[model samples]
Structures are given as structure tokens and as C-alpha cells.
Target chain A: MSHKIKGGCQCGAVRYSTDAEPMVTFNCHCTHCQQASGAPFTTAVAVQRENMTISGDVIEHTQTSDLGTLVHRFSCAKCGAYVYGISDGFGATAVNAVTLDDASWVEPQMEVYVSSAQPWTHMDPALPKFDKLPPMEES
Target chain B: MSKKIEGGCLCGAVRYESDAEPLFAVNCHCRHCQMTSGSTHIPGIGLPAAAFSHTGDVTWYKIQNDRGGQSMRAFCPTCGTPIMGQIEGEEILFLHVITLDDPGGFAPQMDIFESSAQPWDRFDDTLPRFAKMPPMGE
Candidate 1:
């Protein structure tokens, strides 16, 4: 069994625990991620829904991802720091690894959608990357 | 009247103060901003760097900006709040408007990078508009 990952909102009002290890960790360079993260990319860790436990009142904001998938953004109602995102079309959800209690275990696997990546954004040269969404079967 | 705005990282390890009002406000419709804010538009309040004061260590995530220059994003490592953004050549710091005492006071002056905007999106047409960032010098 994978070690449990725990984290919560900035205000500590909402807490979540996951028993399943993240299947994929990616840094997304899409413009939406830039605008939302206010940075060049958003680093996320994906895990199966059944392996996670979430608590506290969360406010959800929905958006259509570049892939035409519905991504539900979950934030703490009290503190407002965006916490997690779950896609409706898939059985997996991506958590903000930065918020995890023990995020060291989840290493970033790749950087996605580099075509829209800001020119100055830099990454470690060794990591694998793709210009657009990676095929689901390959990811 | 100069006022001091005080905010800190989630763990209170980093603190900052901004005395000047933003030169402008903006709402980014790009996917990056969308992922960060978890919203339709990520609004920012831009203030000249000279008017801002800060204390404590802020870890920055450097990114390439649209203008082919480097941009620095300072955030609280403890709390993870995106505190501000700074461009290599510009004197301004794009502070997260949401950190303001009266967040509503900072509103967008224009909409930029709209060429990548979504199809179902609709915004007020009365505001100043630009298909992408205004021709550099404008």
C-alpha cells in the first residue's frame, strides 16, 4: 500500500487524505493554468477517486479544460486557496502536491502543453515533455 | 495618503507591505491563470515596485512571460499564497489583488491576451480591449 498523503486549505479548514499514490504528476503550461496559478505552469498529482478522503465544506468552480473535459476546482470556503481539481470524465483527480503533507514522494513525471508555454519559463532539461496533451493511453 | 498594507505567508514566515495603488488591473483568461485561480479570469493589481515594501524570505517561481522577458513570482512557501509577480525589465509588481484589504477596490482596467480567450466567455465590452498584449509601447 502507498503511504497516505494529507493536506488541507491554507486556512486549514478543509482537510484531505489519500491512501493511493499519485499515478501521474505533471506540470501544465496551458494559458488557463498560467492565469489561474498566476504562473507559467501548475504542478499537479493525479490519483484515483476511491483512494481519497475529503472533508470540510468546499466551494467548487467548474471549467472546461483545453481537452474539452470538465474539471472541477475545489477550494476552501473559508480561506479561498484553490485546493484540488477533479475531472468528471475520468476516475482520477489531481491534487495540489504543494499542499500535501508529504509531497516528496510524488515526483513530477512530465510537463504538458509546452506550445503555449511562456518563452522564459525554464525547467530541468532531463524531464520528459510534450507540446500538447499526451494521449491518455500513453499518459 | 500613504497606507501600509501588511500580509504574510501562510506560516507567517514571509511578510510584505504595499503603499501604492496599482497602476492598473487585469484579468487573465489564459489557461495558466485559470488553473491557478480555478476561475474564468485571474485578476491582478499592478503596482510600481518603488511603492512597495517587503520583509522576509519569499521563494519565487520564475517563469517566462509573454513579452519574451523573465517574470518572477513570489509566494509564501508556508502558505502557498501567490504574493506578487515581477518582470525583469518592468518596475512594477503584479500583486495578487485578492490579498488587498479591500480587494474589490482593484478592478481591471483592460482585458489582454484575448486571442486565446474561450468561445463561451463573455465580458463587458465597455472596458478597454486588446486582442493580445497592447503593442508593446502602448
Candidate 2:
């Protein structure tokens, strides 16, 4: 079903909305995800970059991924809430799932970078797991 | 085993170190956590503020919790990596566990604010669970 999802930063400085159904939803356990989120992993939903619109001042931090691709993380400057990310190797922008105004609906369909998952972190056995980001075509 | 742990933000704009072992560690699933870390939840270690030392440019954002308590979250201004959080009047600072140089060493003893956890997130049954922040001593 097609619907609009809304979210914003903690301080209400940044707001975003997307009407496109997510192409994929997944959890990432790569060390970069860990550092970027200050958590064991991060949950995100990927959508067509053209389908999303964001307002307010946000800053982007670019880092080279282990796969040799550049990933740009965007966050609210006022509250420092991570909003979304863009990867040079991927066509879609990944919005941090937790930033959704109503995140209860998010259900990760897969787990990626499982090889780097922390030993103590738990994962749903029911979801498909990958040692790394699956091929772009598969996603 | 006790060991000194050190870490910094992605842009290297902020750095911190702690010599004392974590007194308590937990995975917090509160909405506040989700907003701050932009993740399902945040893994944090409660450490004595006295034992922690930080350097570089850090920004603090104050937010009032649902309970009307004031919480201050600190992050690196340049990279936006959340470094730590502190509740007003509390002596311990909750350090973002994942920010540690050796984050793999972290072992969460419990899960807190499970009531706020997202449907997609799962927690280990092995850890103690609290629907909300337990009493200070509990």
C-alpha cells in the first residue's frame, strides 16, 4: 500500500516526508554503521531518492566504506539526529528507521553485514542474513 | 577485566577516555534514544563522570524526557556522533557504547524501555528486561 511517512529531528529542526513505498528495509551491522549510530547496528529503509523531501538545515558527513564506496550521512545540525544517508554505490537513499514519526510499522526484511555483528547483539533468525550488503540488484 | 577504553567521533572532532570499568550497561529502546542515535536503540554504559575525560568540540542538547526529567545529550559538532547522555542531577554519564574504539567489548547487562522498542527490533532474552527505567537501585 502506498502511504506517506513523516519524521523529524529531535529538536524539530529537520523534518522529512516520503510517499514512496520502501524498496527495502534492513539492519546493518557494519562497523561504520556502529560508529555512525553509536549502537551495535542501525535499521534503515531505502527509498527512491527522488521520492523524499527534507526541510531544515542538515549537515552531511562523508566517509569511505569498507567496500571502497563513499557514504554520506546526513543529520540535523541542531539536535544531531541522523536523518538519512546516500551511498555512491546505491541508487536509493537510506533513511534511518528510528527517525520515522511512527516507527512501529518498520519490519526489517533482512540483516546485512552480519559477519561484523557484535557477539552480544541479537538478530531475528527469521530474516534473511548476509555477510555484507547484498548485490544492488538483489536489494 | 578492567581496561582503559578510548574512542572518538567519526570526524575526530571529539574524543573521550575512561579508565574505570563501566558500572552498568544497557540497551535503551526509548523514543528519545531513537531520535538521538537515529537507530532502533542505543547501547550505553553508565560510567562515573569523574572517571571520564573528553576533549575537542562537543555540543550539548538538552531535552526533557517524558517523565519531565531533563536529559542532556552530547555530540561531536563536526561529525554528529552522539558521545554521551546525562540526566540532570545524575552523577553518571551514559556513554554511547558503540563509540568505543573496541565496541565489541561491550556487554549489555539489560534492556531498558522495552515498551518503546520498535516491532522490528529484537532483544536478547538472556538480558534482564525493564519496561521502563527501573528504580535507581534496581
Candidate 3:
């Protein structure tokens, strides 16, 4: 059975819960992510938008992604901690898997946005990868 | 807190400078970074949002981050060069280090999100590292 996962914004004012298993999990090394998280790549978990339940006031910022897809960034209205994003490119919502209450359970399967990755950053040797966001061919 | 820096998008559509020192510097090894930069690690420098200054119109795009944060990427649509981004927790706009007028002036202090870095990617051994984004003040 799929496990339930819960998460919230930095201030804990915004919370979310989901019973659906993640559709996918991976790392995005794109410049946007590098700039956003101030890290090498952002670790994310994806699930259907319908499976998630959110509470509290969260602000959203929408833009057309570099891939030409619409993406919405969800954050806490008060603390501005980013909680998740919905992408037309993947037809799914990606939550910062690290923010999940049970962070230990999240597992990443692939890595995207590699082209912009830093020369020094080294990824796992086994995961499949693409220089940029790979097309969402699978569900 | 980091040294003051200056940068903007490629087309000159956006021009801004910042006095805030980077809180941290990192090299991203994710696929999106590679594609966005057409290379490995999008070496990025971070500064608090309040420390920046700019003049010029830039465009933006929102994207999904691995960590579940809302990502606002600002760039010059005309030249298609990314300028900066504003993320949730970190109270700053992430300036694309490359977009800096003097890219050589900035250097990454550490590496984060190393779990997704590529095997062949070469980075300087002198920087600090974390498997994930390190906690602040670590």
C-alpha cells in the first residue's frame, strides 16, 4: 500500500498531506533550482495534483517554464517557504521531498537538469540522467 | 552574509547590482542545471533579497524544484539568458553567477545537492560539501 506523506512550509503555517504514492522522485540541477535552493540540485518528489490536500494560506507564483510549460510555485504566505510546484510539463505536482514530515521515506529515481550542473558536483553513479529536463514519456 | 556582487541577464534587458554578500555558494549537479547551462553544475551564489538593486525589465519563469520549493527564475526574454531567482526560505534572489559581468570574481564556497552530481563532473577539491543542502550556520 502507498504510504501517506505530510509536509509544510518553513514556518509550519502551510501544511500538506497525501496518500498517493509519488509518481516519481528525482533531482533537478537546473539553474533555476540552483538559484532557488541555493544548492546543487533540488530533491523533489512528484505525484498527481489530485492526491494532495493542502491547508493554510499559501501564495503561488506562475510562469512559463523554460520548456514552454506553465509551472506554479507554491509557498507560504507568511514565511515564503516554497512548498511545491505544479508543472504542465509533467502534468504533476512536485513537492520538496525533503520537506515531508517523513523525509526518510522519500527516494529519488532519476536526475534532470544536468547540463547546468556544476563541474564539481558528483551524482550517484547509477541513476539515469538527461542533460536537460527529459520529456515526460511515462505516467 | 556574502561579499557584494553585481550581475544581470544577457540582453541587457535587465541590469541590477547587489551589495549583499552571498550567504552561500554552491554547485548544482542536477540534470536541469546541466541543460540550463549546457554544462555541469550551475555554480550559483546566493544573497539576501533585500541586498539587491537593479534597473531594467526582466522576464520570469516558474519551475519545479527537487526540494518542493516554488522557484521564480528571472531572465531576459530577449536574449534568453537567466538572471536570478527568488526561492521561499532563503530570503534572497539567487543570481546566476554566470550572468555576472565578471563571472570570475565569484567563487562557490561549498557544494550542495551532491547526491545528484554526475560522475564525470570535475570540481575543485577545496570546497566544503553536503549530501543535501546543509543547514544554515553549519
True contacts kept of each: 0.09, 0.74, 0.02
lDDT of 2 by residue, A1-139 (tens): 5645688888989988988888888999988777877877889888887788889988688998886778888878888888888877676788888888877678889999999998888999899999987776522
Q: What DockQ score does model 1 reach against the true complex?
A: 0.07
Candidates 2 and 3: which is better by lDDT? Answer: 2
Residue B136 local lDDT, model 1: 60
For residue A135, give model 1's deviation from the true position in Å: 1.9
DockQ of every candidate: 0.07, 0.79, 0.09
- Among incorrect, acceptable, medium and high, the docking class of model 1 is incorrect
Interface DockQ of candidate 2: 0.79
| Candidate 3 docking classification | incorrect
- CA lDDT of each candidate? 0.63, 0.85, 0.64
Backbone clashes under 3 angstroms, per model = 23, 0, 48
TM-score for every candidate vs. truth?
Answer: 0.53, 0.95, 0.58
Task: Tell me how far the alpha carbon of residue A87 in candidate 3 is from the true structure, in angstroms, after superposition.
Answer: 1.2
lDDT of 3 by residue, B1-138 (tens): 244576665335667788766776667655444434323356777777887888886655555677797666665544445456676566777676766655545567776777765544545677777776778662
Off by over 4 Å in 3: B1-4, B7-106, B109-138
Off by over 4 Å in 1: B1-138
Give the per-residue Cα lDDT of candidate 1 at B14: 65
What CA root-mean-square deviation does each model show from the true structure?
A: 14.1, 1.7, 9.3
